[model samples]
Target: MSLIGKEIGEFKVQSFVNNEFKEVTKEGVLGKWAVFFFYPADFTFVCPTELEDLADKYEDFKKIGCEIYSVSCDTHFVHKAWHDVSKTIKKIQYPMLADPTGTLARDFDVMIEENGLAERGSFIINPEGKIVAYEVIAGNVGRNADELFRRVQASQFVAEHGDEVCPAKWKPGAETLKPSLNLVGLL
Candidate 1:
């Protein structure tokens, strides 16, 4: 089943952010753009590199009214511990959501049932709490924050301009395709 256009279910989880622990809920994520970035685990190879890359672009995401939430099945304490020991994790200013119970992982359909771990998933949610775009990649593969940012930009543009569709490699101020009414019968 596709999660696109699907509204997220209710969830409340603890997060480690800015040297403190706070609660984040589905309600809190509403009324704004959000990115839920799921990884296999913390303190593992490739995860930090991807996370650090996101950290580098955190401000850009924020500037565009988007919030980044990095999620793992690890506990908040584990998140804080890793942040303390690793300089790469320390660079992260966004929330590190703890999905110890797998509520979030299961909700997003990224859960690995046998291992109690999540795959590498990136979800872009709109202000209405519905998923607008998402991608799930192999555990060994890392994703690009720049591409994710571009996707968010595209999604936002398409939402606002319902008649136009973004083209390949679409960026702000780039041309968008407006489907012609006469083309419907050609297909």
Candidate 2:
């Protein structure tokens, strides 16, 4: 079953952040937007670039009351080591969650059992812990943080303004369409 619209905030997850272990559950995400990004592992190509990109845009996400969490199958110690050694990873202020047991990855349905790693998956969960948007990409392709920011903006916009919906390639301040039977043939 697709996890779309499913509430996943109840699941308690143990992850490492800033050299300390912590549990992240519904309470952690309460009253704020959460972005959970699952990647393969640490000390690999593509993942660092993607993470660095997100780090570069961290302020933008923070401004919107969103917290970013990057997850992988590696242990939290590994995450911290990578953060210490890799120049790119050092800039990431967001939490790097360790899913060594693959529980969180499996819950997100992005675990690759054969390799015991996570696939490229991104989930945007609202304050209520309901998943609002999700993206799963092939292992070879890295994601764009700018696009993710735009999606967050659009999602927030629609949440505040119930009558409008973002259209394809929607950007902030762009016109959104109001779904209606009368507009069925208009497109």
Candidate 3:
């Protein structure tokens, strides 16, 4: 089933951020835009590259009132350990959510049962805790943070405008299409 417009269930997990362990919960995630970025595992190839890319754009996401949470089935301790050892992971300022129990992985429908890991999934959630946009791809493929950032911008724009839709390669301040009966024939 599609997770779009579906409200997220209650969850509370330990997160590694700012050289410390913190608690993140559904209540904390509510009332703001959030991105739940699920990866296969920590201390692996491709994952760090993607995470480092996001780290570079973390401030941009925050400027637009969105928070990014990178999740893996690994424990919070593992997250911290990796952060300490890897320069790429050390650059990350966003929260690294530990889903060791697979609660979050299952909730996001990205869990790999046999492997006890998550697939590559990116979810954009609105202030109301409902998913607005999501993409789940093969584990071997890496995602683009810039594209994800653009998507978040598009999602926010559509949410506020309601009547207008973003066109291909749409950016903020670019023209948006307002659906109407007059345009039905064009499609």
**lDDT on C-alpha atoms for all candidate structures:** 0.96, 0.88, 0.96
lDDT tens digits, residues 1-187, model 1? 8999999999999999999999999999999999999999999999999999999999999999999999999999999999999989999999999999999999999999999999999999999999999999999999999999999999999999988889889999999988898973553
Q: Residue 19, candidate 1: how far off, in angstroms?
A: 0.3
Which digits, one per residue and each the tens of the lDDT, describe model 3 over residues 50-103?
Answer: 999999999999999999999999999999999999989999999999999999
lDDT of 3 at 57: 98
Q: What lDDT score is found at residue 176 in candidate 2? A: 90
Worst 10 residues of 1 by lDDT: 178-187
Per-candidate TM-scores read 0.97, 0.91, 0.96
Give the per-residue lDDT digits (tens) of candidate 2, residues 1-187: 7787888735566666665778777687778898999999999999999999999999999999999999999988888789879899989888888789888888888999999999999999888888889999999999999999988888889899987889989998788998797875664
The regions of model 1 sitting more than 4 angstroms off are 182-187
Candidate 3 residues lying further than 4 Å off, grouped into runs, are: 182-187
